[model samples]
Target: MKKRLITLCSTFIFCVGVQAQEFTPKQLEQVKQVRENALNSDLSWQLLESITTEVGPRLPGTENDKKAVAWAVEQFEALGFDKVWTEPATFPHWRRYHESARIITPSEQPIHLTALGNSVSTPEQGITGEVVLFETLDELIAAPQDSLKNKIAFINYRMNRHVDGNGYGPAVRARNNGAVEAAKKGAIAYMMRSVSTTEHRFAHTGGSHYQPGVNKVPATAISNPDADQLERLISSGHSVSVNINVQSEDLGEGTSYNVIGEVTGSEFPNQYVLIGGHLDSWDLGTGALDDGAGVALTMAAAKHIKAVAQPKRSIRVVLFAAEELGLWGAKAYFERHAKSLGNIVAAAESDFGAGLIYGFESNVTANALPIVRAIAKQLAPLNIEYIRANAAHGGPDLIPLRERLNAPIFALHQDGTDYFDYHHTANDTLDKVDPIKLKQNTAAYAVFAMMAANSKNKITNK
Candidate 1:
């Protein structure tokens, strides 16, 4: 009697679970169709190849960056969207040039390094100083001003790899704030281990911050192998010195555009479902993963949905510009579209890379949770589940919309387990992205985007 009762109770719960995830029969059929089509399509790969091959790295406000904006506009129009447009995103331009680093103290050896974004150029003859090593950023901060005076601070921080990309937070702080912290101590220059998991000799380049009214210093990142070499030298109980020459041009104010495309809704045309990834990438390799995969993923999702059927709310795809330079395009997007926040049903971004999306986390209103639950159920074919994360910021490009506008955000959390290995480095090329997993991402985004557009649910709430 006890066993029978347990079995009956379990069966009841399972039935209720299925019932709670209920979608209209037509909606269920559409989800199935979208997933199947996405899985079978190679359009995503083709689109990705086009950008990475033709335009290459889209460093902020450069000529290549302008070409990227144009390419996105053309691609969106070719995809046969009902509307295509561009919005202005103006910001100061920064460009990297010839840079080199060599250890001169204990032994003479070359170290692979690259200048961080917006880093001021070093002296014409370069700069050399004794190395002051720190295991972490916190340690560097705690160092006395006199300790680092007239020296180069070497911050050797290692990043842990995780499927959820949790390690990037701790490791990236070294890149983002190390320069400012070192400058506070009167360091002549700054160098740190690349904020990546891989030990490839390629250095990772990213943005570094300098406080207003604070002295700016040249900052660079050394490859993991190079960092290891420096560490071994330090452990030998001997003083180490290095010479670094970094040249980056501040090209002054420049203009870029946020690319936009739309698939008009069949019923509630004013209501919107937005999906995108940043169009800009760091000036390394071909920008294939940092955001090239993201752009391809969202575009392919919208394309698959349009090929299958139309939804009740419009589907808008944005290929935002200047994301690498601090999400300037996204901020402009919010400023231009804040008035339409009420009409936007939901927003999502696929910026994490071309990894398989294993979960769906949303920040929509309390009432809209069930809507996403139903969407998650539809995504089961792609193995995507509904994880309880209401604070989803969609992606970096959606920050303004998600935070200031109180707009809802949905994120298809990709398995970024190895993403940092190639991120912001020359290894971030087209070959790193798996076409099969990329399509699975398209399927996941397609189902959610189409379903969100078609649903009668309201997304505007706290």
Candidate 2:
């Protein structure tokens, strides 16, 4: 009798557990409805077209950047977002005045190059010296100081292409630190192979860091083809002397701002789902794939959510400033809004080029995995997978929030196979974007942001 009673209790418990696990038919229907709505939305493509065509390249502290900010404000307001505003920040002003390079010895030929952001200008007449080649930065560091004295050092670190472009971070170090490192070794000037994977005649221009106390040097990046040609000449037992001139300078600080829009929630108004892309780009291209795509996607997603009625938590869109030269915009914003960080539920950034999103990862509590998984499953129709992982670096714009605020960042991994080809190059323009892929990315963001805003689980740090 005792054994039978125990068995009956066990069966009852199992039955209750199974009942709890089943979802209500109404809830399942709601999920399907949300997915369908996102798939059908056309706002994504429209937004991309408008921004890319109207604003073009938005280099930091330039006229294009200011124009982009105004355009974004108008776009958000036109989309009927409940609130639109701008937060002020300051950014260092640097402009590319002129860039030219030529091989003076071995052969007299012009080499294509672009000045790196924040690079100093050479003398009015420019600098001419023998070329010293370093396959890597470490090699240059190991060389005798006398070897680099009165010479122009060239660092040739090539970026490897991958589906995720995971090589970009490390590969970019050459561009970021190469100039300063060479200056320390007594080089008169520095040049590097553009941080790109493909061999192209177009030079890639990006930001470089000069150590605070070190003297700044003229720096530029040569196109892959030009770098290759220069390398061949040097390797063939020819003494190569080069003339380089880059008129880049710091013009003090200037005012910039982050554009913000919000769709107020129906319930948890204070809790937030933040999504954004940097509003700044390099001057070389239209910044279409670099960030115009990102801005458009975020705006479209926010507009859609607002049109459909507010979710359970507020959806905030932040178009950050000066992401190209530095993360000054993000840093300033974070400092001003530090207290509100605790209220932020989760954040996502779309800085990667306009590509179809394939997956998402988050640094959140383990208990929130089920909710995140459920959301990912909703996105499965759009071919988005979920990879639960910790967020260490969440791009430039989101880095401040991730570190200082300890905000959980969600990475919407995009197909970066072709991102490097146009990144920071003159080829990055509106024509490079595919409307179909833009739509797909918008759909992913819409579903993910909606689910995150509606969820009851708080993804707070433990």
Candidate 3:
């Protein structure tokens, strides 16, 4: 009976010790000061302007992507980061030569369209055939094979707007697997309604994953307006035929790189607070909002910390490569630095568009929730909320790190109501991003990153 009582007392003592280690009021005040400094800095807008104007489009495995790598290294060195370097990566080289689609029968008209990235080209003369329209993927799968044999299959999937932009997952399947599925049913070519919210005549282009051992077919996306027109023509009971010619080609393997920079910590130089955004973009538009804002935000946050010159833990910044094609850059980094994954205290990514952050979440040990909560208290003044959910999506680029290294990931949830309107479309340019909102996002990232880096607590696997 005495021994049982002693064990209970020891357990109580341990709990009390943990409670005493929580952040004090003074430490929270320091985080607030960091947030203020980030908001006042002009680095976000300035860096964005330079990248969009000078680098223009940074397609993977191309000269533009290389120039972007050089530009990032120079910029980080100029910002007085302690160390700046590049990690080698190999990515696929895809070139969009020329793309066009036209309705050949029943009042001929040209349709606005963009070829999906990494999609193969049609024959030199292009493919001309009768068009078969399906409202959804299920309808296509259930149709008689004779109706689609040697014909062009058009899949129309609509994207609905939401505050959280939850519609991207299901709507994007057409872009990813539509070609393979259509080919299995003996389809000669495939076309899909662009996955976007707006009804503009601008088509959206994104990466499509082709399953191995499946016959690949030419696939492209048409604008929402064009899809509506095509559907109307089919409803009139007239047989419609169209000509699709996409001159995309894959140049053999090409070289690319991931740029990295760091501000060494005063006390724990080996420990790291890793932050990043992918540097590669699609070829169509200027690649401004898809990732230009992300690059600018991370750079600005790191610069702000260096300007103060008193960071308690090292802040590491990585500019990933070929995120649009595949997560090659992140995969290579994890493989090369497999030994150092344990020392990586935390990892955060800024891939979503530059909108005001609404909340923060992390996939860490339950014991680490208090540390995250204390950081949240500092951001509450900016109207940001805290959610206890801890499953980390980690963005598309961080897939390798999340799967292999088991790294604790942090997500700064941003307002994405308007994100899908311009996503993967030519309309995703600089004008879409608001300067004031960009500053607000920068401030939130700076505060969270600062607090996480300085805290002595470690976010281990739950």
- By lDDT, who's the top model here? 1
TM-score per candidate, chains pooled: 0.94, 0.93, 0.93
Ranked by lDDT, top first: 1, 3, 2
Candidate 2 vs candidate 3, TM-score winner: 3
- The global Cα lDDT (0 to 1) of model 3 is 0.82
In model 1, where do residues sit more than 4 Å from their true spots?
1-23
Candidates ranked, most accurate by TM-score first:
1, 3, 2
Model 2: lDDT to the true structure:
0.81
RMSD (CA, Å), candidate 1 to true, equals 3.6
- Candidate 1: residue 259 Cα off by (Å): 0.2
lDDT of 3 at 153: 93
lDDT tens per residue, model 2, 1-462? 655554454333222222223323443355556556656776777777777778777887788888888998898898888889999889888888899999999879999999998999999888998998889878877887667889999988878899898889877888889988888888899999988888879999998989988768898899999999888998998999999988877889988889999988888889889898988888888888878888888888777666665687899999999888889889988999998888888889898897788987777776565556666666778888767565535556988887786677788899999899889999998888888888778878877787788776666653
lDDT of 1 at 223: 97
What is the C-alpha lDDT profile of model 1 across 23-120, one tens digit per residue?
56777787799889999999999999999999998998778888998898899889998899999998768888889999998889999999998899
